[model samples]
Target chain A: MNEELKHYNDRAENLILNHLESGNVSKMIKDASIYSIQAGGKRFRPYLVFATLKSFGLDPAAGLSAAGAIEMIHTYSLIHDDLPAMDDDNYRRGQLTNHKVHGEAVAILAGDNLLTESFNVLAEDESLPADIRIQLVQVVSRAAGQSGMIGGQMLDIEAEGKNITMDELVMIHRHKTGKLIVAPIESAAIIAAADDETKALLLRFAEYLGILFQIRDDILDVEGDMSVTGKLSGSDARKEKVTYVSTYGLNGAKEQLELLKDDAEEILENLSSKLDTDELYSVLQMFAVREQ
Target chain B: MNEELKHYNDRAENLILNHLESGNVSKMIKDASIYSIQAGGKRFRPYLVFATLKSFGLDPAAGLSAAGAIEMIHTYSLIHDDLPAMDDDNYRRGQLTNHKVHGEAVAILAGDNLLTESFNVLAEDESLPADIRIQLVQVVSRAAGQSGMIGGQMLDIEAEGKNITMDELVMIHRHKTGKLIVAPIESAAIIAAADDETKALLLRFAEYLGILFQIRDDILDVEGDMSVTGKLSGSDARKEKVTYVSTYGLNGAKEQLELLKDDAEEILENLSSKLDTDELYSVLQMFAVREQ
Candidate 1:
């Protein structure tokens, strides 16, 4: 990852943790929210928002709340996805699950609280331009709703251990994980009032990054250790889930990631807007090849 | 419930059910959403909204979506509340629990869909006045968030085994159950442009109904039949959870409901703006003395 992008990643994570800490939840709920959120997955999605919004020279402060809100929503989704009835995973970030610590009910409610808090942060704030705020709200509602993350989830649930085509798998991952991962950048572009060409390049940039990330995730599921993954090793193997690595073989998956990384880099290079997304783009390049 | 209220109750329910069914989802999710929402409940709150808006000579069409949104939100809460981690009951309104039918994960997600859909139903449309939409959005948000339903839920969670004071129980029920139950009417009042005096009386009317409704619920838990309830009989009794009937005894709970019902009736009868909440208030009165 580029040094500048890494710095912003840390900045976004710390801000989310700090803001989330200040919210009023039951002590148990607060602690549970912090535990899963602070478990520290990559914050690339939020950093895309902060970096892209700032690439236009807007003060990062102007968008930090939205950045934090997006991350919270992301973290909440991860928590629920890791629940027993969902992914049935026992570890995250190489640690015990939220439900393992707090029990199922509290974990569920904590996720609920975080998801609900995302909108509260957006809607209650009066400092942002109302039109921009409304735009953000629309972006978020669609990105998170049934046609987006939830629909992707439906596909994932239906595809496991089943004969699913590559297109179906791509569709599932795109919505399930790609939507949120890409949303930050596209939303940032919209908020920054980027031109159509710039927006399209950014969208391409996000798609490449999202697919590369998912492919790497599938690879890790095959070979990554529990300690490194903070999750069970060979989880996809156990679920017999069809994945990029499973369908295309590890070598094919690696080649796919390389192709996506090059595409992302090319888009960043071609953008007319003089922006620091190159640093973010470089980070995706590193992410495509790096071990956890 | 009064005969007039029953007519509108049917209308309000059919309207929401149709809107809900129009959404694209798996049969399981659709059934779960409908399962929790389609059953009988006194739609007093919705009636109050339409009546208040109509009485103020505001457009009733402006209130329809909000009315539907409130009922869905209410039904979602009931579904979650009946889950094993919350109330753990197997029945509601003499029907099988949502979790029992759909399993817990789908039930939980169905609740989430309803909540998300509620906001989308408001924000995505241009039917309601922008200002009223914004204001209604804030009302529903606050009512469902930490300081409202969640806060009330936290109290209920904490108060489960304690020496329960009446004030504490009232506070829990008021915030947990009352905010949502009361919000529909207040939302109507806001949209209807009801004067402050009338709004105050409507809130009072809702307040009485919410409290009286809880008391009746407690009384029903004690005497309500297993066949009708579909719940394992005496589940609440086994836990010895705090309730109006538990604290006040049956006769005391009944008397309290009567007094509260009378107070609510007086508020409506004396409403200065000549707002008509009579039919709705009558439902509250019948529900107060209802045998389930």
Candidate 2:
């Protein structure tokens, strides 16, 4: 990662950890909930939240709780996604998955707790106006709920071992991953009280970035090795899952990824005054040619 | 059920079915999501939401969306709680559970969709004030999430087959069931813009009613037969789960139920000017002497 992105990631991680630890709940489930998030991964979603806030020349501090809230939602999805009834993955991010370590029942509850606690955190965030907090809850729930990530997941599961169309593939990624990636940017807009035009611009920028991120992920799944990626290479192919790489092949996928990167850069350039385009550009560059 | 409560129940059911059927989504998972909620349960929680609103002299129509949202959350919990990894029950309310009918993955997704959709419905409620809608999302999330129902569920799972105290049992039930029960009443208060003092009184009233409801459930679990209850008797015992009956015995549980009922009646009496205590009292009486 670039230096600025790394800084945002580190900051986000610290803020999220502090917030999770300070949650008022009984010890046992609290510990399990904390444990679910403590398994460190790139704090990418949260980074976007703070990054968007910073772009608006606002203090990112107020956005941290919301950032953490998004991460909590993201983490809960992963925990549930890794359940025995779902992907059944025993490992994630080079460690035992939540259900493996916490037991399936506790893991499920932990996921439930994290998902529930996320709204509590957002709702109780005193820094933002009540209206803004309400908007955050409203928008975030839509992105994380049926019409977004979870819906995408259901589609993904059903699409297994099938010949899915390009449109279907795009729909899957858009709902599954794109909506959440867009959530933080939209959340930042809500918090900053950005105008509709700016919100649209930010959303457009996020859409490009989301597609780019996923296509690169598909590319990496094919090309990246286990030692560096910390996960199995070609697993998507092994599962016969249709992805950007599966549909367009490596060269086409790379070409599409470049197009998305350029698209994001163009949007960022247009909104240069309203946002910190330089930081976003660098992040885009990283994802555009990421090796792992 | 009595005439008024029965009327509210039917209204809640109709509103919820219309709302669920009207949701715009892709076909397959949407159907599954609808299926999860179409089981024709008693619509008790939604009834409380409308009944509470009616007591406050507000049109129950204003509360329909919020009432439906609460039922969505409740149905989602039942779907997840019946997962093979959880309680693993095949039948609920004399019908196959969501997983049993729709397969595990879809069941899980249906639960996720309902939970997420509940928030969406609340956030978009046109009848209520924006602030009230937001408050509903916050409070409902807390009640349904980790610190409330989900937390209690974890505690219940951990306490299985263990000797537990009355305090522990109460704690579990309060968190698991009581909070969600209290949520609808609290929501009515928010929508009605009741004073803090009134809110406190109603919450106290709800707390007593919640405990009473749970104690009655425990009593029915032991004493009521399948023909009346539409569920297995002694199932709690078969699971070796601790309950009010298990902790206090049959006679003591009945005595405790009486105390809670009296307590609720007293609070209801104090708030008669602000609410329709006659209806509240009748509901309490029904719960107190309910055979199923």
Interface DockQ of candidate 1: 0.37
- The segments of candidate 1 whose C-alpha lies over 4 angstroms from its true place after superposition are A1-25, A194-201, A223-227, A273-276, B1-28, B39-41, B129-131, B193-205, B222-238, B262-271, B274-292
> Residues A45-130, candidate 2, lDDT per residue (tens digit)?
88888778878888877687678888998998999899988889999888899888878878877887777778778887777777
lDDT of 2 by residue, B45-161 (tens): 776776778788887677776777888888888998999988899988888898898888788778877887787788777667777877888889889876788878888888877
True contacts kept of each: 0.21, 0.59
- Number of the top TM-score candidate: 2
User: Which runs of model 2 end up more than 4 angstroms from their true locations?
Assistant: A1-25, B1-25
lDDT: worst 10-residue window of model 1 chain B = B1-10
Chain B TM-score for all candidates, comma-separated: 0.85, 0.94
Error of 2 at B40 (Å): 2.0
Q: Candidate 1, clashing residue pairs? A: A94-A230
Residues A1-292, candidate 1: write the lDDT tens digits: 4465556667667766665566453555667777988787767666778767766777655666567778888887877787776776788776788888887767777777677667666666576765566566666766775656765766576666778888888988888788787778777876787788888888888877878889999998888866666656687878778889888899999888888877777787787356766556556766686566
